[model samples]
Target: MRLNSLYSELQWLPRAPEDFAARLKAAIGSSETDVGRALQRLANYALDLNRLSKLASAIDKAKSGGRSLQPLQPFRLAVLSNSTIDMIVPAMVATAARHGIALEVIQPSYDQVAQEALAPDSRVNSSQPDAVLFALDYRALPLKLSPGDAEAASATVEGGIAYLQTLRDNIKSNTHALCVFQNFVPPAEALFGSLDRAVKGTLRSLIGEINRRLADFVTESGDVLLDVNALAETVGLAEWHDTQLWNLAKFPFAVEFIPLYADHVARTLAAVRGKSRKVLILDLDNTIWGGIIGDDGLEGIQIAQGDPVGEAHLSLQRFALELRQRGVVLAVSSKNDEGIAREPFQKHPEMLLKLDHIAVFQANWEDKATNIRAIAEELSLGLDAMVLVDDNPAERGLVRELLPQVAVPELPDDPSWYARTLAAAGYFEAVTIAQEDLKRAGYYQDNARRASLRSSAGGVEAYLASLEMTITFQPFDATGRSRIVQLINKSNQYNLTTRRYTEPQVIAAETDPEVFTLQVRLADTFGDSGMISAIICRLSQPGEWEIDTWLMSCRVLGRRVEHMVLREILEHARANGIRRLTGTYLPTERNALVKDHYAKLGFVKTGEDDSGASRWELRVEDAWPAAAPMKVVSHGFARPKETLSV
Candidate 1:
C-alpha cells in the first residue's frame, strides 16, 4: 500500500528482474496460485514501469531539444504543516526532486507569520522557491470556542485562502505552478473513536470547509488542484494507511508503495505541470460497435441494453463523455456512409454518445488518414495534439504512416480491454481545467454551424450576416485572462506577433500604458462562443502601432470573423492617431494559412525573412475599407455611434 515501496519494487524490476519477481512472489505467498497468473501480473507491472520510463525519456528528450518542457522548471509548492512536518516535508521534497521541480515549504510558527505569509502585500519569497505545494492538514487552521473567537478563526481561514489566491493572482499567470491541497488524513477510528467525537466532528467540518473553498478558488482562478484524496483513495488506504509502527519500519508499506506514490505524484505533476493535448480522433465501426451498423442495419448491429458487447460500447461512450467533459476536443473518423454511420448516435437507445459530442466527424469511404486530415482542418487543431483511436490495425497503420504527428494507440482485439487500454494511455489528463475547456466542443460545433451556413446560403456575405455574428471586444479582465493566456500559448494560425505570454505576463501587460489587450467573444443563433478569440496589440510611439498578437478560436475561423477583427483594430488605430499599422507573420508548421495575410489585408511587404515571415505596413489612407458590416459589441467602451469614414 505504501507508494514508495511500490516504486522501489518497480525500480528493481528493471535492475534485478529475478529478485523483483521473487519478492513479488513472496509477497503474493504460495497459495497454490499458478505461475502463469503470477507471471502475467509481473509482466503487466513491468510494462507499466517501461511506459513510465519511456515517458521520462520523452521528457528528457524534449528538454534537451529545447522544446519548452514546462513541467521540468522549478515549481513553487506551499507546504502548510502544523505537526509531522518532519515526515511529510522529506517525502514531498523527494517527490519534487524526482520530477525536477522545486518545492517551497511554507511552515508558519505563529498567527502573525501565517497572516504575513497570506498577506496581499507579501511577495512570494523567491528564496523559498517557483510554485506552491500546500501540505497542511486541516488541523493547522485555528480553532477556538467563543462565538467571536470562532468568527476570528473563520476570518483567519478566509484570509489565508485569499492570500493563496492573491499569490496565485499576482504571480505570472502563465507560469506552470500548482496549488495542491492534501485533505486531512483520517485518524484511525479504533484508536480515536472514544477520545472525543466532538473534536473529530469539528476537524472533519473544518477539513470539508477548506476543501470546498480551495476547490472553488482553484477552479475559478484557473490554477491546478491535485486531488490528493482521490489519488490516495485510488492507491487504497491499506497501502498508505497510517501505521503505529511506521517510525520503526525501515520499509514502509512493503517498500513498493514509495515509488508508486512518487510515480503518481510525478505523473500528476507532469499532467498538471505541462500543456494539454488539443484533439481526440476516434474510430467508428467495431471500435464504437460490435458490428457495422451501416452494413448490418441499426437493428442488426450488436448494441443492446442486455448484451455484454453492447454494454462495453456503452461504457466506452461514457469514457468518451468524461474526456469531453474535461475539454478535450473529440472528432470522429470512420469509413462509412455519413448518414448510415450516424444512425446509432441518433436513434440507438443504448447509445450515450450523441452527435453533438463529436466536433468533427468524417463518415466517408476515404482512407482514415485523409479523413483525419479533413477532421483536423474542420476543427482547426494542429495534428500534433491529436490522438487517433481506432480498433483496426490497418486504419491505424494508415494514419500512423500518413499523419505521423497523430498519436495512434494499438488497441487490443478484445472489446472488454478497449476502455481500460484507453484509460491507461493517459491521453486525456487535464492539468488545469479552464472555462474554455468545457466549451471547446461547443465552439467546434459553432464552427460546424458556420460551415453549414456557408454551404446553405447563396453568398458569403449572406452567410456572414446570417451568423448574426457579434464580436464583443473587451480589454483583458480577470475572467478572460486564462483564455488570453491559452491563446498566446497554443494559437499558431492567424497569430501576428506569436509572442507567448504567460498568465503573469498578461497580468503585467495590463499595467503597461502602450499595450492594448482585447478578448473577442462571438455568438450568433448558436450559443455564446464564450470568449472564442483574443487580440493583443501595442503602440510603439505616435502615429504607429504594432499588432503584437491576433488569433481567433479555431472554432470561429473561416467565417470572415478574422477580417472583421482586423478591420476593427484598424479603425481603432486610426482613431488613436496611428497613420500606419504594422504586423508580422511568423511561420510555424501549421500557420501556413496566414502566410499572405498581410498582403491580403493591403499591407505592402517591406522585408521578408528566410522562414517566410514578412514585415508589412499600411498607411491609414490606403488601408482596406472597413465595409464588412458586422455587428459590434464592446465592453468597457462603446463603439462610436457615428460611422467614421475610413
Candidate 2:
C-alpha cells in the first residue's frame, strides 16, 4: 500500500500544492553556491516530500475507517561505514524508526579496521543483521591519475569491480544477508569545471562499473542492490545544480529524501525477506487489448505498435514479460470464445507474449470466478498466490466477493496508466528464487504428461508405483524453513486448520513438547515436487492426538499424496500408543472444495460450533482405508525425543 501511495503522489505531482512548490523553490534558492550539490538537495527534497505526503494520506485513510495502521516489525539493520559518514547515521536511524525498523550503527574505527573486520576470517557475521549498507566512497580510493590519464582511469574502474567481488565473497562466507553498495557522489570540483575533463570521465567510468557490478551481484546472489545513482538521476541532478546551498552546507538535501531512501531500502528488504505473489491471472477483452476481440474481429481489434491504444496494450504485454522473466507465472482467464480471445496472442504481429509464455490458459464463457478457479487448479497454485488483472469493475467485484484471497488490483480509467500502476503496486516482490521457483511453471505443465501416463496405466497403485513415486519425509529443519512458511501462508484448499505462521514462529513451534512437524517431498520419473507439503500435529495425551495443521501443495493434490501423509501420521501416532486422531474443518471462501473432506476420510462428526466449524474424530484402529503402496523414507526421529529444546 505504501508503494501505491508513492505512485499516486508521483502521478499527481504536476498539480501539486503551491506550498509544496514554494518549499522546493526555497530549498533550491540556497543551492546556488555549488550547482551540483544544490540540485541534488532540491531533488532529494521533492522526492522525500512526496513520499511523506503519501504516507500521511495512507495513515489518515486507515484511521478514518476506524482501523489503526500497524507499523512494520522491528528489524535490526547494520550500517557499515567509517567516521567520514557518521553524520548520515542519524537520518538513517530516523527513517528506519518511521518504518518500525531499528537501526544499529556498526562503524569501524577506520577504513582499514572496517575492511579487516569484514574479511572472511573476521568475527563479523553479515547474516546477523537483516541487511548491511556499504557506504564506500570512491573519492577516498588511492587512484593516482591526472585529468587526461585514460589508462589510469580504466584501472580505477577495474579496481572498483574487484573490490565488489571481495565484498561479495566475504559476505557470503559470513552471513545470509543482503548487501547494498552505494556509489560515491562526485564532488563539486568535478561538477563546477574545476577538475579536468579526463578526470571527470574516469570518475564517471568508476560509477558505471559500480552499477554494473551491483546488477551482476543481484542476478547471481539474489541479493538486494540499492542504486543510489539511479535514484539521483530520477530526481533530476541538473535541476538541483541551479541551487548553490547544497555545495556550501554539505548537508543541504531536504529531510524528505531521507525517507524516500528508507522506502527504497524497506522495499528491497521486503523483497529479500518474504514470499511474493506467484501467479498473475489476466482478463481478456479490454483488459489485455484496446477493444473486445469478440466484437472487433481479429483485424479490427486495436493492437498495432504505432497506434496509441495499441501502444498501451504493448506496454502492458512488455510489463507481463518482465514479470515472467523475474519468475512470475502468467495465466489467462477470460469469458469469451477460447479461440476468439487467443487470436491476438497467436496471430498479432506486435504481440510479445505468445502461448508458450503463459503457464495456464483458460478462455471460456464461464464466469470470471469459475475461470480463475480452473486456472488455479490447472496451475497447481493456491487461489491466494494469484492476482487477477481486469479492467471491468464488475468482474473485479465478482472475484473479490467470491474469492477474497486473490488480489484484484484496482484499474485506472486511463489505459495508459495500467503498466505504471502495476509496477508501483509491488505485487511480485520475491525474496529469493529457489531451484523449484525457476521451473515451477514447467512443472505444472508436466501435469498434462502425468495425465497421459495415468490413462495408459491399469489402476492408481500401478500407475504410482510404475512411475517410481518416492515420498521423502523429513522433520522440520533449517533447510526447509522457507518452503514450510510458504505452505502455511499460501495453501488453502487442502489445508485443514488453516493457521498461518511466520518463519520464526515455525521454528518456535518445533520446540513444543507435544508438537510434531514433518515435510513431504515427492519425486518420480517425471520430476521432483521439491518439498511440496507440510503437516504439523500435537499430542493431546497418551493414546490421543490432534492435527493442528495440515496442507499439501496443490501440485501434489490429486496424486493421493494427502492420503499417504495422513497414513504416515497415523503410523507415528499408533507407534506412540495414540488411539484416536482428531481434526477440524473451518469454512473459508476458497476452501469449499474441502468441506466434505473429513466425511470422505471416515471421520465421525463429534460436534459443531456456532461459526460452522466441524469437529471430527477417527478411531486409530480403523483410521484410514487400505492405502496404495507409498514408500516413505523417514529422517530425524522415528519417535519423539525425550526432551524438547530450542
Candidate 3:
C-alpha cells in the first residue's frame, strides 16, 4: 500500500489492531520522515495494549536499522539508571524518536549509576553527553526506620538529598551535561498506609520528604527533576506498577505504560532543546464550550456546572487558565460575529476565563489559518511556536494543511474528553519557569497597547522614543543562569550563531577573563521584558574579539534591542583597547532573520566560508556611531568614562 494510504489508515483504525500494526510497520519501512509523521498521526488514535506492544517492536526495528527518527535536532542522552531499564529503553527511544528527538539513550550498567555519573574516566562521563538522565527510583532510598525515630528518618532524607547534590555537582563541575534526575515515586507498601502523613517517620512520609527535597535541590541547582510520582498517580497505581515485572526486571512501571512514561521524558528533554509551544490558539465553538455562542446565545450555551456537556467545557477552560498562568499565551480563532463571541466571555457567570485572560481574541468570519497568522504576527512569534487547539477536525486539518508549522493536536471525538486529551498532550512542557513567565500575559497585553501607541505615534523611531524604554546590561550571575541558558537554547529568529549552551558551559564562560558574557533586560513605560537578550564574545587576539553567541528574545524584537546589545559590546571592546570586533552569521533554517544581521549593524562582510557562513568585522579605530535610541545602562563590567561611538 502507498505511504499516504498507510498513514490514513493508521489514524483511525479503531477495530483492526493487527491491521494497524501492519500498516505502521509498512510506513516505517518506506521513509524515515514520512514514518515520523505517520507515528504522530497514530498518536491521536487510542491504541490498545496489543497495538502498543506491536508498535514498540516496530520502533526497535526501525531504530536498529539506522533510520534517523529525529531529523531536526538530536539530543545525546545517557540514562544513568539504577533499575533494570533495558525493557524501558526501546519504548523510551521510540517515544522520544516520534517527538523529533534523536534520542540515543546509553543505559549505564544497572546499579552503577554513581560510578558512571561521577567518575571522569567512566563511560558515561567520558562520552560527554548533552544531557544525562538519572533514572532513579525508590531503590535509592534506605529501608524505613522505626515509626517514632523521626531523627533517623530525617537523616535518611538529608543523606539522599546530599548524595544527589554531590553527584550532580561532580558531573556539572566536570562536564557540560544537564543532569535530568527522576523524582522518587513512593513505594506501594507504607507503614501507615493512607495515614502515613499522620506520622513523620513513616516510610511514605520519608519518601515524600525526599521528593520535596529533590524539588528544592533542582530549584537551587537549575537541574531537571522529572515527577514520576505524579505520572504514576495520573496513570493509576494499580495500572502503573506490575508486581511480576518489578520482581523479575526491577521495572518501576508496567511495560504497557512505559510508552507513556517515555513520552513524558521526551517532552521534558524536548523542552531543554527549545521545542515547547508558546501560544495556544483555541476555537470558540464546541472546543472551549459545548454549543455555538452565536446561535445558542450566552446563557443558552453549554458551559456551566448544571449540564454535563457544559462541565466538560468548564474543565477545559480551567486547564487553559492554568496554562495561561504558566506563560502560555491564550488566543481565540473562531468563525463567529465578533460582538457575539465576546458575549460569553463577558456575560457568562460560570465562565472561568474572562476577557482579560485571553491575550488575542480574533473572533470573525475569516479563515482560521489567516486568523492564526495574524495572531503570530501580533505576538511577534513564529508559526512553529503556536499550537492550534480546535475541536473540529476539518478546522484542524485546514490549519495543518495551510500552516503546517502550527501544531494541531488530534482531538478526541467526545467533547468530555477534551480537557483530559489536551492535558496529556504535553505540548507546553517547560524546563524552567522564571519570574518572567508569570508576567508573560501582562507582557503580551503590553504588546497590544504598544501596537496601538505605535499606530498613533506616526513613526517607528518616535514611537520607540515615546515608550521611554531603558535596557540594562548585566553579567550572567548564578541567579539568572537558568534563564540565560533557556534564552540561548530557545531564541531562534534573532540569533546570529544559533549556539546552544548548558548552564555549566555558561558558568565557565562567565569566569573566563578573555570572554565577555552579558544578559540584557528591557523595560518600558508599559512593563518589564525580563532578560531578553544574551551576548558571548571571546577575545580572539590582543586587539580583536569574536562574537560567539548573539541572540534576543522574539518578544523584544523590532525594538532596537539588538542595537543596544551591539553598542554595549562595542563599548566594552573600546574600553579594553581592542581594535576590532568580529562576528559571523551561521545560517540555520530558522535564523534567516539574522542572515544580514552584521550588515544591518554596520559590520562589513570580510569573507564567506564554503558552508555559506559569512564573516563580518568592524574596525574600532573610527568613532562609533550615535548610541542606541533607548536609555542604556551598564553593570558588572567596566565602562569607558568617555563617550564611545557604536
TM-score for each prediction?
A: 0.70, 0.57, 0.89
Return the TM-score for candidate 2, rounded to 2 decimals. Answer: 0.57
- Per-residue error (Å), model 3, residue 532: 1.7
Q: Between prediction 1 and prediction 2, which has the larger TM-score?
A: 1
- Model 2 local distance difference test score: 0.63
**RMSD (Å) per prediction:** 9.3, 11.3, 4.8
Between candidates 1 and 3, name the one with more favorable lDDT.
Answer: 3
Give the candidate order by descending lDDT: 3, 2, 1
Question: Per-residue alpha-carbon lDDT of model 2 for 1-646, expressed as tens digits?
Answer: 4433444243321222446556434533442333222222222221344434443333334335544222233344555543243344544543333323334445444454246436755434633655566655544454444346666666766676666667756765576445666655443234325344325345554465556766776656545566656555555444213235344443323333454455455545544433257888888787778888899888887778888998897788889888877668899988888888788888987778898877788888789888888887777666767888888888877886688657677777777878876665556765555666676766676766787788999887688777667777777887787678667766766777767665546776677768877888988789887888898888877777888887877777667777767777877877778899888888764567777777877889998898689998999898766564555667676653321111
Q: Where does candidate 2 stray beyond 4 Å?
A: 1-129, 133-201, 214-223, 230-263, 305-308, 335-339, 342-384, 392-421, 431-433, 448-521, 525-552, 558-646
Worst 10 residues of 2 by lDDT: 37-46
The TM-score obtained by model 3 is 0.89
lDDT of 1 by residue, 322-364 (tens): 8887777788888888999899989988778889889887899
| Candidate 3 lDDT, 389-497, residue by residue in tens | 8888888878877886677777667777677667677788988887888888778988888888888999888888888888888888876887898888888888999
Return whichever of 1 and 3 wins on TM-score: 3
Best by lDDT: 3
Error of 3 at 393 (Å): 2.8
Error of 3 at 258 (Å): 0.4
Candidate 2, residue 75: the lDDT equals: 46
Clashing pairs in 3: 624-645, 624-646, 625-646
